[model samples]
Target: MSPAPPTPAYRRLSVEERRAQLLDAALSLFAHRAPEEVSLDDVAEAAGVSRPLVYRYFPGGKQQLYEAALRSAAEELRHCFDEPHEGPLLPRLARALDRYLAFVDGHGAGFTALLRGGSVAETSRTTAIVDGVRRAAAEHILSHLRATDPGPRLRMTVRMWITAVEAASLIWLDEGKQPPAGELRDWLVEQFTAVMGVTAARDEQTAALVRRVLASEDG
Candidate 1:
């Protein structure tokens, strides 16, 4: 029988490769299930490794693994808005939303776990990680507006849009991603323009930004 095809030799992974393997497995679980619903055994089994090996890598247990997964997700979320400044502002925003919403759709339950408080695995560090993503998103929006030193009103307007985006994302997940992602993205872009218009009525900086955006669109 050809000696069972001479069983292939097992190759060992480097430390970084092994860690990434475990993180990918854990993140996959966390992406579809709540942090509390996931266990190290699930991760170990997914990674084709033993529980001791998981514990060996993450001595702080599931909490540590959860935090690591959250950080990795946060890093990706922060970069979702890092688009080139080559297009009209609204189109740029739309492109950024496309990436952000794709992440939201892909992560679903994990996104909920990260944003919604009350998980057993919640910690100050995890909260900070989530908050960092929000702050980074706000900053990116401000940069897109070309506002280096945004006034209080302009800053609040931008931040409020960021908050609204987050709330809408959560709602989208709850509604089973209804309204379609492309529709939602376009709607969000409109909301930003509308909110900026409302703020521009009272804030000179926002007013100027609106004019520049309009001129760009016209151009």
Candidate 2:
């Protein structure tokens, strides 16, 4: 009757739901090991679906699956920037550091795989994930700099700040994650604020420009 209620327009899912489903499937495989090592059948089994179903979402197969996992990690890191905090850089920096640490704590395997980049499937995955993360960090630092300095040197300063933070985190992870989470968090906040002039700036003059660029690009 009524043309079968129009099938509710096929009930298209929201993009977020589809993305979550894909990420769940990929993350499981990544947790196990390299995407190349994990077959489509394995991913389907992990996701509790048929092989064709997984292919339906990711036609590129293993490579696509690995990329999805990498994208998921990037999205998680991007979440830290979505917070709407208005204050000195230290608090914001601390909040971001806490968020990052929490993500690593929750998704240890995902983070580790992303960081190591050993496997063929994981190599590209790692590159994509790290690029996204580095961009986010650079953009955050750039915003703080523009808010304070607003000069030609802001870009270089942003790059240095981001690289420093990334290097520190990488070293910490390489050295067995020992220094304690609290101590690491404090250090990250202090280092970011000290290098980026977060407390000295009243507003993010460059955030608008960066946001425009991000809104245009998917990564």
Clashing residue pairs in all predictions, respectively, total: 0, 0
Best by lDDT: 1
Over 4 Å off in model 1, which ranges? 1-11
Q: Which RMSD does model 1 reach against the true structure? A: 2.2
C-alpha local distance difference test of each model: 0.90, 0.64
Off by over 4 Å in 2: 1-19, 122-129, 145-154, 174-176, 193-219
| Model 1 lDDT per residue over 106-137, tens place | 89899988898789999999999988888898
**Residue 186 in model 1: lDDT:** 94
Q: TM-scores, in order shown?
A: 0.94, 0.68
Q: How high is the lDDT of residue 154 in model 2?
A: 52
lDDT of 2 by residue, 87-133 (tens): 54456667777787777666655566667667667565468678778
Q: How much lDDT does candidate 2 score?
A: 0.64
The TM-score measured for candidate 1 stands at 0.94
lDDT of 1 at 120: 96
